[model samples]
Target: MKPVYVIANNIISPLGDTTEKNFSLLRQGVSSVRLHEAGNRSPIPFYASLFPETFWQHHHTTFTKFEYLLAQSVNKVLEQASVNPAHPKTGLILSSTKGNISLLEENAITPQLKAEISFTQSAKKIAKHFGFINTPVVISHACISGLVALITAKRMLEAGLYENVVVAGADIITRFILSGFQSFQAVSDAPCKPFDANRNGINLGEAAAAIVLSVHKPLNDAPILLAGGAVSNDANHISGPSRTGQELFFAISNAMQEGAVSAADIGFVSLHGTATVYNDDMESKAITLAELQQVPVNSIKGYYGHTLGAAGLLETVISICSLQENIMIPTKGYSTPGTAQQMNVCTVLQPIEQEACLKTASGFGGCNAAIVLKKQ
Candidate 1:
């Protein structure tokens, strides 16, 4: 299989706009998470990373908030990477769990708005906005959608289906999502504390991220390779993950094997540490099972909350910043290791000496996915 390099990336998150800008803020331990008022999106106030309601008012657009974020992310990445969206060898992939689901709040959903609710239609509009030549592929496999999109792009590149792929993911928290999590009793009252003993639940956040993957070497940053990726299902529960984390371990093992790397070679691990009790514990078991107990692990959920479909991609983008800078961002709000299996969770910004890193995610339906990145 051919090697796929992350040529250019953009993250339009609450932290910052560009990758470098976000990384700079992260290095200083700055976070965007804050207490947001209930407004029309929830019955109660919640702690989450959100742009102000009027953040986009200056930029009038016909696109919905979700599509606007996606377009902004893509436009920046394309401009930075100089990738031709209209190239026949280039493909576009959009991933999200709830695209335009917020339209339900309207008094009456118009036919046009109803049509825009479909993921494919949203992708079509985003593609047309950028003059993309191919029908964009959509991945909505829960929270792992972003990583799954990257994996899919890698496969497409290796199969010679595309020379370059723009993998973008965007998800905005809405009343539907907030109520569902609250119904599950999973919404945290405070800033999420991943892997912390006092951790309670998760904070929902929204973000959009885009990364350009290509067969050619990048002209700018360190040559980061999306070397290996694997996805798995534990069939444990519809919402709960594998009790033993064996399924996630399988994905980690398979990913490393395919990447031609081993646990000993990894520098740090970007986690799906949603700050939820079970999630932190399950990931601990999975990492230990894979014999990565010593690898420094961190999560950005404390910075951006759980970004849902965009979580995987958003975290990956930030972690890529970590790899580029040879520094690891701490798992914000984690003051203790609360998982049953024990994990080496980073509590502060630390220097990193290695180049290979692993990123993992587990979502609803007992699904788990992992991918390895190597800097050459």
Candidate 2:
């Protein structure tokens, strides 16, 4: 098997356009989340991190908004890497829970445009735009889509199925989405607070993020290896995670096993930490069960809101930046420990000599995933 490395990455969020800009804003503890008035997005007022209309004005593309956002992220990443999308040895993978779902509300949906709703079709169009020859892969397994897509990319690179793979994930905020979460009472009225005593629910947001993985090392910086990844399911509930968190713990254990690292070797853990009551509690148990209770942990959901499919990829990119800068970003809206198990939830930005980091995510339908990254 070949060693896969992250060559470049890009994030299109309310905070900024590039990974560096987003990292800078996060370093300053700036959050784009705000209380949004009830309009076309939802019938009731809710807090969310939404991009201003001006953000779209900068991207001049003929593709639909969702497609264009994915392209914009990929374009930025391509600028940072030497990989060629037009080459035969390259592949593309897209992740999204909802793709162009907003179009269903339009007055008339033409047959041609209706195809955009299928995640695979949208991936094909985006892949063609970049001249990729292989059939594009699409993953839409709830919020875990992004992390699973990345795991697939790593396997592909290591198997030598492709020399370079562009993995991107995105989801737009729409009435359909807001209503679904609202029905479940999962929408927070204010900014979401992860791992806090007063935490309520998650704030939905929209974003597009892209990463380029390659077998070859970059010349400019130390290679960041996509060390190992593993995923598991609880088989307990569709919308809820395992009460024991044993499944998620299994994922963490399997991921570390694959990376050939022990819990003591992990510097920090980037958590799913969605501000919901059940999620934080489950994760707390998982971390403790894995014997990583003392490792500093932080979640960026408060900074960008729960961006659906984009959440995992976006958080991973930021955490990769954290590893490079030796800084751990604070949990933006956390003040007190709220989980049943005691864990080191970071509350302030601080520097540390991190050699490896763990990223974890759990979503709708009993799905759980964990991945490890290491500096070489």
lDDT scores for all predictions? 0.90, 0.90
Model 1 segments beyond 4 Å from truth? 59-61, 107-111
lDDT by residue (54-166, candidate 1, tens digit) is 76785555788889989889999999888898999999999999988988776487887778788988899899989999999999999999999999999999999999999
The TM-score values for the models, in the order shown, are 0.98, 0.97
What are the per-residue Cα lDDT tens digits for candidate 2 across 104-143? 8773777866776778778888888888889999989888
lDDT of 1 at 130: 93
Relative to the true structure, candidate 2 reaches a TM of 0.97
Which one wins on lDDT? 1
- Candidate 1 minimal-lDDT segment of 10 residues: 53-62
Error of 1 at 84 (Å): 1.0
